[model samples]
Target chain A: MITKDELLQIIYKAVADFNSMQDVDEQLAQQANQVLFSRPGFTKEGLLDSMGLVNFLVTLDDWLDQQESAQSLHFDISDALENKEEALLTIDSLANYILLKNKKV
Target chain B: MSIKNSHILILSDTNQSNFSSYLSKYIKDAKVVTTPFNQLMQVLINPTHAVWQQHYALIIFWANPKSLFPDLEKTLIGKHEMLHVKNFFLRLIDKAERVLFTGFENYPNGFYSQFENISSHNRYALNMMLTSISMESPGVVSYLPGYYSPVVKGLHAVSEDLWYLSKTAWHRTVTDRMASFVADMWKQWHGLSVKLIITDLDDTLWGGIVGDDGWEQLRLGGHDAVGESFSDTQQQLLIWKKRGILLAIASKNDEETALQAIDRHPEMKLRKADFSTWRINWEDKALNIQSIITELNIGAQHTLFMDDNPVERYRVAQAFPDMIVPNLPANKLEVPAFLRSLSCIPATGVLTNEDMHRAELYVAEQQRKNSMTAFSGIDEWIQSLNTVVSIEKLSHQNLTRAAQLLNKTNQMNLRTRRLSEDALWNWSQTPGQAFYTAHVHDKFGDAGLTGLIGVSIHDDELFVEDFVLSCRVMGRGIEETLMNFIISLMTEWQLSNVKVACLLTPKNKPCRDFFSRYLLSDSHEWVFDSKARFVVSGIQCNVIDFN
Candidate 1:
């Protein structure tokens, strides 16, 4: 099961101008937490779970690719994800995997 | 920070501010050279010493770029310059793993217009040709549309859309069509199919069961609504048999009654000879399925089981779940659509000679299966085919098909390796690396690009870095031909040692028997002792040299 907070983090990474992880986390916490956001108990750990992360990463990937500016931000998260047995199991995992496989990591 | 950094060697006028800030932020290792674009020809003249030091992963040229083009006055000159740039681009692609051509002049249509006016159908055609060429040759191209403001620097990066507009429709249709075309070709190329379809012979093939209805009352074939529908459906199944997809009977009925029904019925499209296998016994569905899979030398996954009985469908689904057991349509009217849906996988692009002989080859395989009952030894079984091996060097066209086989093939594959379109070109364009893939053809038919081997030459030694064969042709001495062919090349090259390694994968156990004779062990062992052993092989074989 996925939580709202993880979904928010994925969206944040994809769209937000926030440069740091802390900024991303804050935006997620604020945007999430309400049951209206879909899926209750919106915790960070719930968001990072395998299925949750994959959905998050796919959304983030599409958002990043759509951005017209900021060619400098590297989307290299592959090496960290490659350690997993199934390379595409999670959102963060896939985002990282694509980055590394393309040598962006 | 590490991710953002790229070692870029830009040969643009440094005075330009367009992508400088963006490059600084995105790329960690930036070597912004002030040299003009034309000066790049001078820089690459002494590639080994001068350009080697830069160790640039990518190079960008930032300018009004139109300034370099003195005029489009002489259309021929512009064309010649484009050709020169294209050739130079190819050379760069061969040298570098990845290359991008961006920052054409800032005019709205300036970038695309140059290539568009140069006698091509559309921008996409030119772009796809270039992209496919780069893809085939181990490089890629990207364009950077100019940035209007500092805030949106590096905003208009060239990717698939800007590079080629026509690819969207071409890829969608091409990929879908290609999949089915490849599937059909695979059936023909292999020659032998699963021994039987083992379909239920009642409402499954026709509108009614013969056991329940009298022969005259039973519906099948030609005129009068449902009868014609049954005839059309039965003819479609016959099409499968003509392609060497064998039919089988697994009807739950008295043997005499079923035989009589098939023999006496006027509308029946399928005759007695159409079935090479049958299981019309009053046994459990599970037992019949197991027998069919065993007798066919096929897995349940390869078999397509059809039955009209809901209880039977459920039982078979539970018993042999791997078999393709499509549900009987709820409407019963949409049966043809349901059947056609199964033909979705493609069967085109590249086909081996064996593909044309597939149906006949399957018939031959049946003969072999029967002869096996009389013959005792493995040698006798193999000797019957008078098998031939044709090994060849990888050419420009077969590369895509060869790499595809390498990616999908398992069971007999030595190392379960997966390579992308880009990586295959990298191997081809990389200097001193001899990439060879083989196509196997015998008495049956041509199995196109069945084997692939990648050899890298370092110093004077030849190395078998990667080798794999399609599992479909495994058991036949195809492995022997591959290894011996490599050794022949090693001998011709005058290399003392031919280094080989078999990377282990669970499904690749068949390769263990292969390396036993050639590599001396089923484990990993590096054969090269020194750099002198790394030499290119000049050996040739008459077996697969068609050209």
Candidate 2:
């Protein structure tokens, strides 16, 4: 089983990789709480819009699927987006949701 | 940095700043020029626009018909307008070297619920028509679907919030994906492919070190799962070799021990004869790779190095940043997936007869090198080689190889003009344009078609558009013989003068030096007066007419 710190690092690395390809603002992507700031509900002036949220979710889901411990952990971001679930809003919530799904929480 | 002297023009309905930014990430020197948002018609009508004046390596048209023509389903006038737009884009394709047309992303549910069925059907028809047109005109037109509809549903490819906020319809992921796709197409069209794969031994090739485990005990080519995975990796390397990619070994081990395993192992899929060369000694792996690349006479940019040890891979990557050094997977089971993921292995739809026989040609070159020491004088060696040069007009059979040579050959190329295969064919078909390919062979073996010359006749004067010789045949007097042949052809055609285009590029210094010594030139044009006696005395090669 993967620890929360390792999972956080994985999420951070994925965001970094995705940002490397995108034209995202360096200030938002380079922050320690980038995932939180990227949330649609975090602030009215949040850096990431709906598309950015979707991309981050998809990328995080893919990273989780590739991990040996979380091989069976499959979270559908499209479904979550459609349902307007609060768990998909912030990085901490999303990671906790994924952990809950994997029975690690 | 983008590719030097390359430009890409983008015409899209939405603001293309994001797309342009993503594309620039992949293509270092590419100058990307995007039309003003939704101003496609204005640019299309005015040929004097600065965008139209520049030579674009690629022209991209990204517009959703549904968004561009909102009333298409309700009115016939909208359909007619779309047809006019399509015709305008087709005309632009004729003017440009390569054009990429993107299909519409599927409409989200709330946007146009009433005309959903009709809109979907029309988009499918549009994509099919574009695909058929692209097929008929290979290397010129490429149609890419905006989204894989079945795989991605509900949200469509466009982000609603971003579209409202910034007028950027396509999502960041879509833009990123398109960037990669365009980069691949550019690489393929230019014949910038990985030619060589240098691999390590021990943990990379097998589970155990050969020196410690001995030939029989090494975990390779056995019923055990670990051994089978190693064998599977070797099989994959062999498959790549068959695809015309040259393979070599750069490992730190006893030469005799490694050779013994490769030569005598019952389960070894790869043998000692498989590799073009091997450097199996306690030397710096980076230096070994350098020696291999130098010995093969290939550019470092066209080589890929693989090793299991991360330190070695890092050292090689640091030494030669241009060389591809893929990180090896920790689990051996992931090796096959890792190998398949490499973009360097896939052929760019331009495989030629010469590419298939590359290994044999290199071996033949080695044989020629061995025979060189036997002859005391250079002239004697040239005379005794029994060299035959066969010149033939470019045709469908050799078109791929001819285009590959034209795009990839730089050192001895006169003009260094890279043309797409379709563009080259179109140029060759022009009236009064003549192109010839030279096939070289000696007593040692067939060197295959290694030289190309293109000329155009205007007002009784022959203009040399392209004159390129393969660097493999550089030291020989083949260039002089090719020039003599051209002069003879000009004489036969009753041309007054032969003018060579002497466009100098950074890499074609050798070609410039050759012209400076032989052809009399004033600034840019190298002229050969028809009345002047062009001596072709000392070349012992026979020029055969190949129709």
Candidate 3:
């Protein structure tokens, strides 16, 4: 199973990747870490729009697949995007969900 | 090269936000927008629509041929024709000022390569039709090179996952590579391509330093591996030269000894005549490069300097940051491949007769300069060469070469209205525009199509559109002859006013100074009185009737 620190580091890298394409103003406006990973139910409070969320998630998905232990693990946020949207509200919750999914495997 | 804040519109059937994202990353300051998905045909058909109002400098139309043709399998087997697809894209030629039509790759068709080897029939008919689109369109449309590019790098163009996920046909890498390609091509089209390459003679050109190793020991073409590598490097440089890139040497060595090595070296593929000029001394490479480019009349931005020593490279690189100073591979064997990989200058283009023989033209220029010393005075020297200039209105036959002069001339340009051949052709078709070309020849050699004069005639008044002369024949009386032709034109037509349009550029100060005598006021337009008798001397000028 992946450690929490490893998972958090991946999120940080994904955030940097996301910020690479963003303007400085957008980067500042969307303090992804403050709004995200701030609380369990912070989806509506985050600055990421629908496309931004999908883009960031897709980018994060691509990076995760390149990891050593990812082993064809897909970045499917269907459950979070569906009924359990709060699972993606915070970085900790997302990390726990990923850990839970990997442990199930 | 500075990327002009050009607005670019992406017209494609599929989602090309990836294209916009890449262009945003690479083509800084340029605004890139994609039309709504499935709006390619609508955008192409309705060019005057609101989306086209973005004033896009370029419209990249990338659509998969299979998707466009629907019956691609039948088309490949010759069961169905691809004319409708061709005409649909051809109509887009005049739709925008510039449309970069990214050609379709040989994919699903490429999968049938095993069958292609056994049969004589070609499977890549789609690629051919796409090329024809660019050919018919000319200046208004450009074809992105599809084969053997830096972008191709053995990567699969289509991503299955992306195709399934979001209908994005290609991978992100394709977008990135195409962005770079477009930027480079854009710069080249705007006259920012490399015109000259200045190289070091010692370790850069050959394997060993000629000064330290002596003439006989220099590793150039020979049986040894290092020697062969140097020979390969020379071969690469020769290719660039043949493609119209002028080569010069800037080295720290005795002129006599180094030249002797260059001449006496039996295995040398290059000779003294190959270089336009050389700077061989203990002087700084930076200064030598400066002198070489200055003597040749090329902008520093249009030059590339190469040296094996990093210190020398760094010094020159720092001095001229705009100049291309490739950090050559440390491994001697790798230098040739590295240099070969550079696409700074477009590798593929229609090479005119002038382009193919450019090195010899420069050599002839050197001869002309040398002959200048033989005469007692500058006037006597100018009269001695027996210079004859043939002038004719720019026609379809000589349009390409004249367009070259139109775009390339820097110092002697009057207005510097640089234009592509197709644009120039379209402009010349205007009822009032009269564009003329000057072909110079003398005792030295034929300087093919070295001057251009374009003007717009309105009733009794005339406006000079473009008056440009190549540096090869700058100081000669060609400009005066061309000017005299304009005056004679005014006399023949009985015009009241003649205004020469002049725009000041950093390199075009020569033009400003030339027009200073003709100017009545501070206006860059040097207005001339038509009734004055302006006689041209020292040139046997012949004006061909232009119909």
Candidate 4:
């Protein structure tokens, strides 16, 4: 089973990878344990472009799927991002949401 | 730093947004613009498309032939489609400064001939055709096998969900590595590559230290596993040497002892002759590396250091942060493969005849230096050597190497201009501008094509846009010889005054120093009277007719 701290670290790693790809102005990626602070119009304002969202979500989901505890439990990843109208609010919210879906936890 | 005025276009038939993101991350500075998804054919066949209006420094055709040719299973239809693609691609290559195309089909329609799978052969055929076209393309088009390296036989390369949701063919885990490979490919094309590899001797190069174990006890090639692995490391370094990477030693040992081990070892894959230079003394490895770098006249960023000792590796890394100091795998058995996988190793691309004789060229430079003691003055030494220089109008035969020199020559460059072969040729086509290449041969040996000077005429004052000479032939009166040719060119044009467009850069102080003789009072500009003699004695020049 994955712990909350471990999951946050993975997300932070994905953020670092994301920041490496993005310019300074486009770096909405905060440090680990730091709030992501995404709103509805974040993508519209060009803080994070369409591709950045795809890369971030895909990177996060790939790590979650690789966890041994999540092997049998198919993650409800579509709902994780398909709530597209309401994008990521904070780093903690997504961590809490993933933990809820992880039955082993 | 971003390459000045580098505009890259990603032309893909599949959704390459992730590839673009990864590319932007990897290349960092270049302005990357990705076209709409699956619109490659429209951009390729349509000249009026927005892509054609603006020129690109590089164009990547990331493709998915499965989508491009849905009729691949049908023989006649596929044949027609292939013929159409071939014809238009040739036209497309004419428009790009340099083009990087898909070397493999990333997401084949089906696995190739696996377990009763019949239709996948067409995808394999598609791959083979792309490779064939990339090989024979008249322009600078190279198929990209870079991204495919980190991928293990296409395993985990693609995810069905990502493909369905976003249409990105490559998995996110793999894109970062892919981006690095692409960046290396681009950097190598500009002659920015790791030129020298400094390796440690003790446990890094062999199984045991030469001074302690003695030559007879050192583990190199033999029947044993450890001995074979040690020899394997040497073989890998030898391959890099054959690829034009100069090998040098930086170890804490007696120079003669190390050389003796290299000379006397029965199965040593590397020889004393293979190393261009070395600093095998009991000093700080970083200082030793710096000495070798000074002797070789290459930047630290263009060097790679390999050492098994953690402290030595860290020390060198701290000394030269830009140098590629790879941490050899802890397991000795894995060392060879890990060394082979380093991205800083010289790319197989851009290898010319000059590359094959690069070490010999360095040795020739050393010999020229060695004989310096025999002469009273530098001029006398230069006069002693019978030097002949051939200046040719830019032609296809020498265009590739000329561009390489224009990019590689940093110290002797006037403007520090870097351009691809096609870009250089394109600039020459503009009115009042011409570029000439200089090839030098002396009593010592051939220096190949080592100099370039681009000039433009504006109101009778010949403005020298670029004046570059390779370091190998520097200080040998080649600069004066090239300058003399330029002055003669001015006389032929009936122009009396000449101005150099020299830009002072951190590495280009040598250029400013050389042009100081012609510097106008107080200003950085160098204006010369073309009527005055500017010839180097004991040198013969041949300038081809320029159109």
Candidate 5:
């Protein structure tokens, strides 16, 4: 029952939460999708670095588990990254992959 | 109180942009100056440089041994260099108002292969040495723990890829956690601590209401899992009460029914006597909490109110924003975990004897208040209570309590200079310096050491540097008695006059007024006149000299 827009909003909120922890600017948070492949001030390098990627995936997993309708939907970051690298090329692609995974479940 | 204008200087071996960013959120106007990456040695060797001359409210020295000295374990010279580093910190301690050093975190095995054990041992030894140094130095030095081990599997706190990119040693997640930990340390250093906890009943204290399900049917303290969860919550609250945090109740329930359950329930860990006060009525919960605060004579900022309902929490928060109103978990089972996460209470450094008997002391205060109507006059009331003052010189036995009183007591503090344990010890060793603590006891109970006085003989005059008494012992003429004792000491030492230093603070008006009314004073010093007539006839005093 999770729509793509709802999943995108959840991902955005998770990103905002991470940004606020480091006191990053909200404008940089809004440009998360655009900066996925670029180096941001908050992160050491590209947003896909080991620490940044793990923090975002863990937050997303926790957020999904908290939702009543999506508790049973499992999305492992390692499995997704290994099987469908192109699906996580950008923030929008990651949301699409989550929506597709929820539909399959 | 606002740290918006404060400056903080950070000296770290790694790139500190992430740490700086995180600290900025808590202290908005904090101007942070970071040393060049891997330049801790250069900065420490010559701390008298122009860059170090700037006034900073706080200075943080955060450096990892691995990054600072890569071959520290392989060479003998590196060990000597480590000792030099410790000496550098001791030197830097005198330059800043407040300084904090983060202890080195250990690395996991197999990372350094053959050098793993040696590296770990060296890091451990270095950290222990630094901790001891910080303890012996003046009150300005504090140690902050920086180790982060993930409790959840598949989570890493150190990322090699991130370190290679920007030279940021720790992961962003670890940095975020450290930021919060450092902020708490800063708050405790400023003497901010929680004193009282006001809790609600019903779903908060038990699974079901006693009125709805009857005391027998209420799910609390039974073999059932839900019942045990509620019992665990009550047990935790009792432990906090035993450790000097006053507990109270502010629930909207029938007073008689609640009292019966609290008093007669076989499973309840807390009895009717456990609470200092309660307001189980139909009035607004905020109003009830206000009454409790007023009765306790504690600031709203030092009180915490907890309830299960989010609406009530919001109402209290709106009414008293200074007070802490934590949001409760939706499920009753999560109550214990939620309570454990409260970091508002600071960790007690050294537990004094008074701390262990605080609950009994508060009960004695109530008894004293009840007996006040029997006496005809103030002196008669004081005398009828049978009070005694025992004075002892500063020793290791009472050093911790002495430092705590100096830092936390505001109302009756003269010269209001907070001294760290090490600073107080150093002051006591100076020639002709005398420090004393007054232990007070009455018919009600022993109030413990509630008064402090520090005097030093300079030339023909005895200088009073610090004189403070706990406000709990105020209005009993204890201050005048202490002053009289100091004057007696001056007369015995053949000093010409007694000079007292008074610092003007908004909270210390009572202290200034005491000197202005009785003692002759000039612009900055109050000189005791030997010819002035004064009577100090209330309490019996005993003085013990340790020198």
Candidate 6:
């Protein structure tokens, strides 16, 4: 399970990391999330619509790939974000997603 | 830097050959992952594919022709593709360093159509949008027009023309226009102001050697024919001087002859008064240029040197690669047009008060130097001008100048980090971000927006992320005023142990000594916490109102 806030944190960090950002602390990270998510529902897709999300995701993926003994997994977090069917959405979900996918090996 | 950890994910359907493999050979840092073109939406949605994001620095998005537009079943011509491709480019402009347009090699029949379509009226709008984005962000979006490469010959048709025409039109076009435009989209980028135009007097400015030919016989100053062309060039140079470009002449001739021709010749437009410096000596031209650069306290890149003599031009070019050496036409008739193009048209915006006072400022500097030679102490020199510092919290009015200072102020810049307008806007929106501008004025002139600093607060720790001051205002005690102001702000807020870090840059050695100089504080790279110490000095006086 991954919550929107957690997903956003990862996304924000990813974007910052991709940019070689040195001092994007929690405060700036929160603002970045707000900027992307603050708009009305109409612009929610706009937040992740263009290169911003792509760059962020790409950066996150690169960092994760650098981890020793990297793992890959699939976990359905859409249920948590969209349906609100699950309450747990944190950095743990991201870790578990990789763990679960690697379990197939 | 080996890109071993990097990966590139290409989303394309064409089986023409694995372009990813081709890219892989060139780019070895990241593994290349090529997925079938239509699977974009699915791949993005798939949580498993997130691995691609973690492994790659770049994502080459090759649009799948089939899934993107199903209605156009037949091979879409370049125009039709471009109409759609334009949307695709706009969509991805935010993500990539540059988007390379390709298709001519594989599909030549439709290439011209795509090129023409992209070059149509919509091209201007696209260029405008790209330029607008560049203005806003810096280094974030660049479109490699399809015509840039033979295999991808479409959008570049216009860009190439635009690049060439800008020079022909006598406009100071953007340098590294497309790449810089994109880089500017994400960061603040700077351009050198062509302040001083240094020229040779004999063949460069007018036709004849004044030392040998004398005023009357010297092929200058007349409406007859060749002399008329010489006067035209002089008039153009005079126009530039009036517009605030500093004019200087370095001629190896008897100074009296030049004075006589300029003073007595009826057709002469450029006179002795127009030049800021006249190095009319038999010394080496290169040495004279070196003296000019030192006297102005500007970089070689900011000076444009012109000489009709090929050997002289070669000598200067070899010595200073950065100095602009426009080709001097062999024929005198072409001199006027060449000089006309050499005139600097100031950046596309309104001129500032400081810009208008630049000539006065330089003159004041000369006066200050002459006084310094007569004065006994350094303090006497500084005190002579009655310098005053005025600090103002950042505002919209001076944001552009603030950005300029952050990007261009090198020697005294602490952290030496360049930021884009979008980044600044984002920072303003962020919590705990503080920005301020400082203006210094003395008896000489107003050094406008002389300094800028950006600070961020996290928990109890305050971070001085950027501190920069313009070179023009460096010698004055402005930095002390800025540091004192920062400490005063912290005292007012009751914040403790304020930490300031100075990042090393190619041109920022002066900044490394900042804290040590005025504050007598130690700096370290460890994550700054509340325990850090910043001793505040209590000496203040004479605050001038610059607002």
Could you give the TM-score of chain B for each candidate, in order? Answer: 0.55, 0.81, 0.86, 0.90, 0.82, 0.66
Give the DockQ-based CAPRI class for model 4. acceptable
The list of candidate 5 runs beyond 4 A from truth reads A1-105, B1-11, B21-34, B44-62, B72-146, B149-166, B169-174, B458-460, B516-525, B531-537
The lDDT per prediction is 0.52, 0.74, 0.73, 0.75, 0.73, 0.55
Top of the candidates by TM-score: 4
The segments of candidate 6 whose C-alpha lies over 4 angstroms from its true place after superposition are: A1-105, B1-189, B215-225, B231-245, B259-273, B336-357, B514-547
Q: Per-residue CA lDDT of candidate 4, range B84-131, in tens?
A: 766655675766667787655434445322212224566565556667
lDDT string, candidate 2, B1-547, tens digits: 1147588998876778778877887777688889887676678778888778886778898865654456655554445665665676678776677888876555555543432433555666677667766876766787766544422333236555446545676666667667766776677666566888999989888889899889889898667888889998999898888877889999999999999999988988998878988999999999999999987888788898989999999999999999888898989988976786565565335467887888778777777877889999776776677777778788888887898899888889888877777778889889888788888988888888899999889898888888999887776667877887788778888888888777887788888887776655435567787665444344554545422
The sequence of per-residue lDDT tens digits that candidate 3 reaches over residues B208-327 is: 777788889988877888889989999998888888889999999999989999899988888898898999999988998899988887888899999998999899989998999999
TM-score of 4: 0.88
Question: For model 1, what is the error of residue A99's alpha carbon versus the real structure, in angstroms, after optimal superposition?
Answer: 49
Encode model 4's per-residue lDDT on A1-105: one tens digit a residue: 667787777777667766766667677555433434355555423344455566667766676677664445445546766664333556677677777766543
Candidate 6: tens digits of C-alpha lDDT, residues B456-494: 776766677777887776655566667666656566556
**Residue B72, candidate 4: C-alpha displacement in angstroms:** 1.6
Q: Per-residue CA lDDT of candidate 1, range B1-547, in tens?
A: 0111335555542222223323443232444333433464455555664655644445443333233443332343445665654665566554433345443323334544433233223233334445555455432333323212321222332223312321111111122232232233233222212324668877777777667885667777656666676676677677667654657778787777778877888888888877766787688876887887676556676677878788988888888876767786754456655565454222122333433344454555566556656767665665665565656666766766666666556566655555544567577668767667776555554555677877777677778766787655666666666767766676667777667666766556777666664445656654633332212122222455422
Model 2 residue B37 lDDT? 78
TM-score of chain A of each: 0.34, 0.69, 0.73, 0.65, 0.72, 0.36
RMSD of each: 15.3, 7.9, 5.3, 3.9, 7.5, 19.7
Give the top-scoring candidate (lDDT): 4
Best by DockQ: 4
- Give the 10-residue window scoring lowest on summed lDDT in candidate 1 chain B: B166-175
